[model samples]
Target chain A: MTGREPIIDIRNVSMRFDDTLVLDDISLSIANGEFLTFLGPSGCGKTTLLRLLAGFESPTSGDIFINGQRMNDVPPHRREVNTVFQSYALFPHMTVFENVAFGLRRKKLPASEIKGRVAEMLALVKLEGLGGRRPAQLSGGQQQRVALARAVVNRPLVLLLDEPLSALDFKLRTQMQMELKHLQRRLGITFVFVTHDQAEAFAMSDRVAVMSSGHITQRGTPQEIYENPQNLFVASFVGEINILDAVITGHAPDHLEATIEGRRGALHSRRDYPDGQRVKVLLRPEDLRLSRPEDPEAAEACFSGVIKECTYKGATVDIQVEIEGGKALQATEFFNEDSEDIDYRPGEPVRVSWVRGWETVLPDD
Target chain B: MIRIVKAAYVSLVYAFLYVPILVLVVFAFNDSRVATNWQGFSLRWFAKLFGNETLLGAAVNSVLVGVLAATLATAIGTLAAVAIYRYRFLGRKVLSTAVYILTIQPDIVMGISLLVLFMAVRMPLGFTTLLLAHVTFCIPFVTITVLGRLKGFDTHIVEAAQDLGASEYEIFLRIILPMILPAVAAGWLLSFTLSLDDVMVSFFVTGPSFEILPLKIYAMVKLGVKPEVNALSAILLVLTFCIVFAAQLMMKERREK
Candidate 1:
């Protein structure tokens, strides 16, 4: 999907529903054959943006271009984009085969072609023998597959999925996430998936756009978003991370020093900030390492804190260490049989340390 | 003892509701022309009912008006329900609420209002006026019925149709109509029955030249309650049962499958 020309370009689109603004100046350029996700909390405008792009709605301001053609006035029926709705939205009266063949029939395709295409789509979605069944007869996952087949059978230029997997159980959701990603790759159609699940978005999207309060807070690859959240909301919303109020005590061209309570830690920032600037620093739980206070390698900035709580997660143990100023910092460590620190109990004193570059300095807002 | 008492009470309520109808049905089979006494069981009254030219003509007229009024009302009302469901415009709330008001309003009031309107417009008191009045009342019933089905109806399915290259017409034809057909049919059946059973509105608008079964029965009852009316009422009751039973079966099939 790399180096492909832009397919759907949404420029400064804003949507307002009566008195409330649903989407605020959302601008995005989707590359052809790329799978992008709009990841956000509920009422954060991700679904609204997807609706706008699918031509279910026209923007209150700005324009949307599909294949570089203005699609502002194009109705959903005339647009080349199709949607896999959150509810699956399969026509209850139609059989699975009929549902998938609906778009082809609308195009006035020959009967044989419509049959062949519907059959092929059913096969693709692994619903080959169940075409005679109505949507109500199928399970949730099967209905979802029918919906996907129905949307993709038309070979739409862009497939917009609005939280399509939200209705499935956890196990089914995980399984369908991989299948949907695989299908998108196989089809190579530009897909814009909207979801509130960060894990699902991270697992499938090539680039995830994080939205909050009707604004795109950040748009980047999953790793970039997880490791380098630009704002406090993105940092907290994307995944669990420790946010600490720190005062910038020293400023340098490429580095800065922040003091939390009486302890100072060095951080590498792209831009220099003035001294005494109040900012928040985000530290991932996985990035924090715990060691004994008397261990030989107590180098760099290490904080001494009493363990407030320790929880044994399946793969890793989450330990909350209370540092100075009564602030609790969470640190996670994977379980190892040979590891001596696995038995770290509550109220035990420990030293927490992290490398300089692992910390993300975020804007206060 | 309590269980027996409860059962007795339930039976009493059922008897209270059905005894009159049961008596009417039993008398309809009586051999005598007078309805007061039970004569030997025979189908003479049913034969007379079929033999009566005026009553048979009115019955035919009632069927014609029922079919026409129900069809027209269902068409207009289903479209109104869809429009009220999908689009937001001025007076949408008032229009939808008006359906409920119309349904709950007294039949005489609606009939009198229509009569006044027809009189004011100088529309002749005849089949056209009667049919129009029937359709006007039936529209609210159809709207309310279809609206009940549309309560949990997924708007996303409509959007999905449009997204899949279906125009508004195609979406309604292929998706919306089929999805709500059961409700529409239920509405149409209800409207048909209401039109068939109607007397007040038909009495207000129908001229002597154009008569419906209910008004004719009302006139006959004024003259005297006869075995023929009993047989006709029993037949009408059976027809209503068949239609309602069929509707229930359809609904059950949809639920089960």
Candidate 2:
């Protein structure tokens, strides 16, 4: 995705509603033909950013550029962008065909071309032969497909989707996630998706921008974000993370020496840190390994504690181990087909360790 | 015994409501000039009603006022309701509350106030004044009807239209108007009916030169109850029932869609 021209550019944009600032100074660039997602919780300004791009709102300050054209003064109808609202916002009085054909009609396309394009778009969404039904007569999933087809039929330069799949059940949501990803690939257009669910963002987006408090906390691929989070908020928001207190005592040529949970170990980091500086070590639950205290591998373990609880999750068991100094850490262990070692009883003694370089180290804030 | 009591109770309520209208409808076909005795079954009064030029002229005048007032009120009221629902301007809350208050105000008070306004303005009391008074009172009913329909509307649909390349005027014409057509039609019908048979407001504003159906009927009844008046009342009653029935059917269709 490097060296590609950006389709949308937001420069030093800030939005204020009355006395409260909804979005602080922020800037972002989305490359052409790339799928990018804005992932955040509610009131995090993800939807506000998407609205700014769609021309439904104007920033209190700063300029927006789409295809190198200033869009701050352009009204929504004249902009070459479209949106799929969270509620699906299908015109209730119109049939599926008319709703899908609305944009084409507005562009003054001929009748025959509008009919052909609407049929092709509906077919892409797997809603063929159901064009004559009103929105009220269709199921929720069907209405969602109509909304998608309606926006994409015009082939806008950019498509803005605001939590477009949050209304579906688990099975349908996952299925639509795959379909949306595939649709973006087939269309070859830039897609800017906004969602609060991290898993949903990772499933469909090529790059995810994690947002908090109206700020873009981190931006990277899903693997980069998970393995090397820039801050504690980004680390905890992307997935389940266990934070352990660590203090840097000294530095070696390759790795730093830290006192972690009353045990001294070599911590791998690329950034330089001063001696005796306080830091926090972050680890994913799935990376932690568990074994019995008397096992030979226990010699390399970091801490020994009694198992507090075990939850069976069909494919894996989540174990809560109370380490030294009353700190509880969660470790997820997968079950092998031929072994029953994952089945552990409460109050059983266990040894917890992980690969030395797998942890992410960040300064305490 | 309980069934008999329930039946009697239902019959009493129905008779109390419909007995007067039934009497008028029955006497419309009487051959005799006096309304008390039924000489024979004939359409004599209806025939006389058609030949009487004064009654016909008054009927025409009432319809002209009703159509003009209802059309103007529907246009103004629909715009007012949309503004109240969509914008966040200053005094919006006060304006909405004022609309509700007008809907519940007494007709006699409105009539007197309108008469005083016309007199103060030095406007002559004729068709123009009558039309203005009818339009003034009919606007609140139209606004209330349209606003009731707008309360359940989802505003996101407007945004969706704009996102799909619809201008403001296009959105209103193609999306909002079509969706709220049933309510708009019902409001127009209601205003028309109210203007057609309004007696109190018409009494204050209308001059002697421009006689309307209701005031003319009142004057005739003051002398004695005639068969011609009964025949005219029956016709007006049937016309009102048809309007109400049509409005209800439009509402049901909207709900079904």
Candidate 3:
């Protein structure tokens, strides 16, 4: 609760495999009972970071304190953290009840207490009646739940998930994501989940760290990351962002005027950047609007372009307008009677307008 | 027509390989005094052989030595295979080379060399030497058979066992060993047959005190070919065939499971 105390602290941790640096110096912490996710593409060292926290590997030069205990040489079994791998890794020869009871058995608990706790944990994961069956007999999701129950029965301080839902189908993964999040909240256990799916991380974690090339590029709440990204990598990686090269013409307090191609326009962002700097403006498709350039109420710097691509997606229509000088502007028209007015076929010229008051301008191009 | 000719050629090759053994068995059962004549069948020679104690003692000795040699070879070979498969350290190549020599060396050379080495060490040459010779040759065969199975062994299962909190010893005892049991048993049975049939090594290693069934049969054949040896050969053939057949059955069961 104090500013100086964090439940988990990682400082300047780096992992080098031979000559290649697998994980660069990374420092971060999680407060008590925080659901944190390390999200990135494959081989981005997110899994390596998770393994470091679980005491599977010692950092090259850094300190990891778990609940105020320095855990440099501690083995994974001796640590207060447990990891659920993507394979589920339930013992094939043991029954569900025995598998769930294994860790406690290793701790040398009494038989009566072990039996009681095994049943309780299995029921907590909704696997009570299936105790007699082996892991091979269970479905993918069921086995995953058994793995979760097995790890949690020991009451580890932290639960580490290494792409636990990567093996599930889309619908099953979403269902399990919700279930896992709820289970973590109910148990009041800090869950550090590692995955590469943006939607899964956003849907499950209280905070997500987007890692790239062995370093965290950005870390924030799902809303903060989606609404405000610090760089082009973050903007493009976190969500769907359409980036356009623009040279700054003038700088204002709230917005920047820039020349995009031969067209001159103004782009709005809460973050201020220097004028006449070559920057890329990130525009989401939903922010662009389609209108006729002849409209008197339209904003300044309107140019006409032929529709390059169009796709109908449920309630909205996505139209890509290729402006003069081959600039593609992606615009979405809301489906309704209003869509009829904005309806334009591919190769038809129409004015593609974007709201400069919401687009993000990037610097250090 | 060419396919039919190929099929006929395959059949001819099989007949060439097996028909002589069939002929030997048939003549052994015939009551003819000569090699080609057919007379009434009788169990007179087999009955007389059962009354003789020396051939029976040699047969019993062969069975005992075969069991001991196979068991020892299997245990040592299984441990060596597991150790080499699980860990890598120095002297592995040298040890592996020694084992390769044991397997690939000619039987007569190995027999003569072991005889010289045993004599140089002032070792007793009897059942002990015979058993030692059989076990040495069988060890390499057992190791090779089990090592092939170990090469395909799934290490993930061991890691999975550890992740579920099983200790290192328990993983080996419960998971890895059980998964390779069929191969180990096959190796043991193979060693048993090889020890039973070893003539060259047994000839160099045996003494006047201990006699194996194969050496006794050879001695009998050189003295005067007996219908008794024919009867015993038929029985030994059946026993060896049964062991090989049982091993194949066990292998098939493992695959099915």
Best by TM-score: 1
Model 1 chain A: weakest 10-residue lDDT segment is: A293-302
Instruction: Report every candidate's CA lDDT.
Output: 0.89, 0.91, 0.83
Error of 1 at A352 (Å): 1.5
TM-scores of the candidates in the order shown: 0.96, 0.92, 0.86
What DockQ do you compute for every candidate structure?
0.86, 0.77, 0.33
DockQ of 3: 0.33
lDDT of 1 by residue, A187-245 (tens): 99999999999999999999999999889999999999999888888889987999888
How would you encode candidate 2's per-residue C-alpha lDDT over A193-289 as one tens digit per residue?
Answer: 9999999999999899999988899999888888999999989998889999899999898899989988888788877779988899999999998
DockQ of 2: 0.77
Error of 1 at B238 (Å): 1.0
Error of 2 at A329 (Å): 2.7
Give the i-RMS of model 1 in Å: 0.8
What value of lDDT does candidate 3 attain over all alpha carbons? 0.83
* Order of the predicted models by DockQ, top scorer first: 1, 2, 3
lDDT of 1 at B159: 89
Place model 1 in a CAPRI quality band. high
Correct interface contacts retained, every candidate: 0.93, 0.91, 0.16
